[model samples]
Structures are given as structure tokens and as C-alpha cells.
Target: MNNYNTIVIGGGPAGLACAVKLHKNNVSCLIIEREQYLGGILKQCIHDGFGLQRFKEKLSGPEYAERFVNEVFELNIPFIVNAFVVSIEKKDGYTINVSTVEGIKTYTCENLVLATGCRERTSKQVEIHGSRPKGVYTAGAVQHLVNVDGVIPCKKCVILGSGDIGLIMARRLTLEGVKVEAVYEIMPNPSGLKRNIYQCLVDYDIPLYLSHTVKRTIGYPNLEAVEVMEVDEKLKPIEGTEKIIECDCLIVSVGLIPENELAGRIGVLSDARAKGARCDLDFETNVEHVYTCGNATHVNDLVDYVSESGEVVADAIRDRNDSERKLIDIEVKGRCAYLVPEMIDVNKKNNKRVMYFRSNKILKNATVTMKVDDKEILRRVYANLRPPEMERIVVDYPELSENSKVVFEIEEAK
Candidate 1:
């Protein structure tokens, strides 16, 4: 049995950040990573844009990982590489049974941080009817091939899904001398960051077909062409709008789903909307002492946010001595998709609290009003807000009375 003060079940930015923060406070932790090396998906992402908020400088994915890896190494934090945690069971008094190499390993710890991250939704998940061709690959898979394995999947590519990965891949393939025919998005607006759309697609002269989708892929051994079509507001295909684009490869970047198998195995409560474990303000799950962060909690587009979440978990673990932690549930109704840390406990030591949430619809020049039992407590106006971009709001802790229910609502600003 491998015993530690805490166990972090991932080696990505979130996991590493949590380990580093815990280690700084003299808390011993073991980070178990399934990959041969640390960094997780960040290792395969070679493009820059990460670390802008975290480090105040733009860095490539690997570079960002290296910074955290070096920090962990400096702290002498031990990690198990190539060890997949199949299941986790809370034993007597918080010991975790982490199934890994050398059989079922048990770690006695006061806390467990889950940073398992997320997985890209594949073509199979979307059930896109098409020829099973060799040239079709997920944008992340192709990214791994080109950036990690140093192999380009194809010369001519038609990318489906204008999400961040697809947009970035479009630019990446173009830089590799590959002909990127076009990028198709089912939504009217590109599902990626506005900056990415401008820099990766528009600047690269790649055509972005919004409200469009790939109807069918045509090819045998490799991709040859894709039948693209426009869609109505309801996303139903519009007749007579089918157009074929000849390409040697098709890369799908549909979306990402939080990897929550381990979370489910432990019987942790999860929100179907977030598709991740439901966490409290301390990042703790329904199961006491088990905390979740990063993409494992929700798909965060920026690494900075992941690190921020790590810090939250670390703070909670460090401040567990506080017995006055009071549970406060945050309800998102009316135009809100969901909120992170579905619940929170106000720390009596501090009267300020931060909350993160995303809306179900895009709002331009709108105000977000937060209330407790129908009484307006806080309100903030923003120039623009989208569901894809997570937003943070702060509330006065003193305003939260005992048994008070808080609700968040979005309204157009005058």
C-alpha cells in the first residue's frame, strides 16, 4: 500500500498545480498519471496562447507544462507515471483504494484531489454518418500526431466543427504546408474564442462556414471529399444547400466531455448539465474529503482558470481545520446553464466570495443579477457575455444569511 497525505489523480496542469500548492504547504501528495510523462493534453498542444493570465506571458502548451513540472520537481513531489487509476473507494477514515500498477494500491490520505481532465468528443459520439476512412481523425489526435509524433496526417484537410481545437488545427495544418480547404461549424457563431477565430482562421485566410456541417464524408482508404450543408436556425439541414469539398483528410473537433468514470465509481454526485462532479465552494464533492478540479469539474477553455481552480482546492485542503464552514447552494435559473462549485461554504474568516458561472445564451451589454430569496444582492453589467467563456462574480459574504437561497439571473442591460 502506498500511503500519502493526499493523492492527486492526474498529472495535467490542474493536478500539477494542486500538487505544487499542497507541497508548498508541506503536504505530501502523489500525482498518478496514466501517461508516460506529465502534462497530459498540454504536452501535445504546441501552439502558443497558454499562460497569458497565469504567467503574464504567452507560452506553448509544452512550455507551460514544463514550468509546473519544474516546480514539482524542485519540491521533490513524487509521481507515478503510466499508472491508470481504475477505481477509487474510500476506506476507513478517508483512505483511498486507488487501483493502479502492482495491483490494488491503497493510499491513506486526508484528502484526494481529482483532476482527471476531459476527453474530446469523437466522431463516433456525434454519430456522423460517413465512410470509415483512414484520413479522418479528431483534432486532438492529429495534434498529437503532428506535434508529438512529428507526423502530418494528410496534405489536404476539411475540418468539421469550428471549436478551438479545430480552429487551431486549421492554422497548424496550414503552417505545416497542408492545404486546409475549410472549417465548418454547426452553430451560427464559431464555438472558439473570438481571438482564435480571428488569428487562426481569418488571419490564415481559412474559410469558416457558420451554421454549416459536414453531411457526409466520401472516401475509401482515405478521405476524398465531404458533402457540406447549411442549416436552419433549428440546426436542421437546409435542402439544396449541399456542396462537396474535395479534401484528403477530415479532422473533427466537435467538443469535449469531462472524464468522470472514476468520479462515478466513487458514487460522487455529479451534475448532468456540467457533465462533471458536483463540487462545493471548497471544490469538495458530495463525498467528504474528495475534491475535484480543472476539466474534471467542467471543461475550462483556459489553463489559467484551471490553475485558479487548483488554488481553490489547495486553499480548502489547507484550511480544513475551520469547523465553521457553512454550505451554501447556488442555484442557476433563467438563462444560466450552470455554475461551478454547484455549492459553496462561506468562510467566516472572510466576508468576500467568488462564484463562476456560464449562461445558456449569449448576452450583449447585459447585466447579471444575483439575489438571495428574491432580494437583489449583487448585479454586474458586461459589454458581452457568451456561454463558452466562463464568467466570475464576487459577492459580499455578510449578505449571505443562514438558510438563504441564492439565485443568478441574466437580463439585458439598458
Candidate 2:
């Protein structure tokens, strides 16, 4: 049996960030990773684009992860690789039963952080009617094979979603001399960032078929073709709009769902909209001393945002005993899909609070208005808004009164 002040699950960017912050605060912690390596999904993301905001320099995914890994090493944070946490149960007031390889280990900690990250929504989840054939893969799996394992999955491919991973894969495969037949997106607008659309698809001349879907897949023992169809506004297949594209591989990047089985096992309250834990402003879950961040809380597109989430969780844990905490509810409405840190408890002494959220639909030239008890507090406009891309807003404690209800909405500017 091992014990620690804090236990962080998964060695991804979020977990590493949480562990690093705890270490800096002179707190002892342990990180448990299922894989032998600590980098997580970032290891397979070899393309440069990460670290623009966090490091102020563009770096490959591996490079960004290496920077953090170095910090973990320098701090001498203890981590167990290839150790999967099968279950977590709150034992007493401060001890948790963490089932792992060496055996069922009881970890007594002041805080617990869940950074298990997210998993790709697979073709099975989408229920695509087709013969199960070779060469079909999730975008992340293909990324690992190509970028980490250094092997191409196929020569010709068609991506089934316009999410960031699928769009990036289209460009990646194209760069590797593979033919990307097309990227089919059922939504009217691309699910990924506008910048990815311009850089990865438009620049590479890869066609993006919007309001379209794969009606059926055709292949023998191996994937040979796909039947794509244009859809009406209702998303029903239009007659006579079927087109066949020959491809040996099909990559699906439909969406991501938070990996929260462990959190759920311990009966943590979760948000219906975000499919993650319902957290207070301090990133603490309904269970005291247990915190969650990164994709496990909500799917964030940028690694920097994940790191920021980690810092928030750490700060909350560090200040858990503060007596001036007041719980406040943040209501997200009007075209917004979901918001993170679903509830906020203003620490009057701390002076500042941050909120993260995303819109449900695409908006152009719009201003996001936030109000506390019918008084406008903050507003910001963006050239565009999409659900997959997260938007962060910061608010000061003084701007909101104790026990105040904060409301956030988005509207287009004339």
C-alpha cells in the first residue's frame, strides 16, 4: 500500500500539468499512467502548431510534451508507467482505494485529480451501415500508427468527419503521398477551427463536403470504396445525390467523449450537457477533495487550455480550506452548448475568477455578453464562434456579488 498527498490519474498533458503544479507548491503527488510512456495522445501529434499561446512558440506535439516531461523529471514527481487504475473508491474521509498492478493500493490524500482525458467516438457509435472491412480506423489511432509507430495505415483514404483530428489527418495523409478522396461532414459548417480549415484543407486542395454524409461503405475483405450522399436541411439523404469514391482507408473523427468511468465509479456528479463532472468554480467535484480538469472535464481543442485547467484545479486544492468561499451558479443559455466549472464559488480574497465555455452553433461577428444579476459585467466579440473551439472569459470577484447568479449569452452584432 502506498500513500500520497495527491494522486493524479493518467500522464497526459492535463495530468502532468496538475502534478507539476502540485510539485511547485511543495506538495507530494503520484501520477499513474496506463501506457508505458507518459506523453499520451500528444506523442502521436507530430505536427507543429501546439504551444503558440502557452510557450509563445510553435512546436510539435511531442516537443511540447517533452518540455513538460522535463519539468516533471526535474521536480522528481513519482509516476508509475503501465499502471492502470482499475477503480477508485473513497475509503474513509481522506483515503481512496486505488486498484493497480502491484495490488489494491490505498492512497490517503488531501486531494485527487482526474485527468484521464478523452476517447474518440468510433464508427460503431455512429452506426454506419456497411461491411466491416480492413483499413477503417479512428483518426487518433491512425495518428499513433503513423506518427508514433512510423507506419502508414493505407495509401488512399477518406475522412468521415471535419473535426480537428480528421482535418489534420487529411493534410497529414496528403503530405505522406496518400490520396485523400474527400472529407465528409454532416454538419453545415466544419466542426474544427476556421484556421484548420484554411491551412489543412484549403491549402492542400482537399475537398470538404458539408451537409453530406457517408450513406454506406463498400468493400470486400479490404475497404475499396465509399458511397457518399448529399443531405437535405433535415439531414435526410437526397435522392440521386449518391457518389462513389474509391479509397482503401476510412478515418472517423466524429467527436470526443470525456473519459469519466473512474469518476462515475465513485458516484461523482456529472453535467448532462458536457458529459463531464459538474464542478464548482474551484474545479472541485461534488465529492470533496476530488477535482477534474482537461478533456475529462470538457473537451478542449488546445493543449494550453488543458494546462490552464490543471493550474485552476491545483489552485483550488491549495486553497480548499479558505473560509471566504461563496458558491455561485453560472447559467449558460441562448445558443451556448455548455460551460465548464459549471458553478463558481467566488473567493473574495483571491479577487479574480475565470470561466470557460463554447457555443452550440456557428456565429459570425458576434459579442459574448455576461451579466451578474441583470448588470452587464463583461463583453467581448469574435470574428467567429464554433462549438469545438473553446472560449475563455475572465471575471473579477468584485464585479459579482456574493450569492449572485451569472448569466452568459451570445448575440450577433449588426
Give the per-residue lDDT digits (tens) of candidate 2, residues 209-318.
99999877898789999889998999888999999999999999899999998889888888888888888877888777789988899888899989888888877676
Residue-level lDDT of model 1, residues 292-359, one tens digit each, is: 99999988888988988887788778877736557677877767777876876654343455567887
* Candidate 2 residue 57 C-alpha distance from true site, Å: 0.6
lDDT of each: 0.84, 0.84
Model 1, position 16: C-alpha lDDT score: 93
- Model 2 clash count equals 0
Pairs of residues at least 3 apart in sequence or in different chains that clash in candidate 1: none
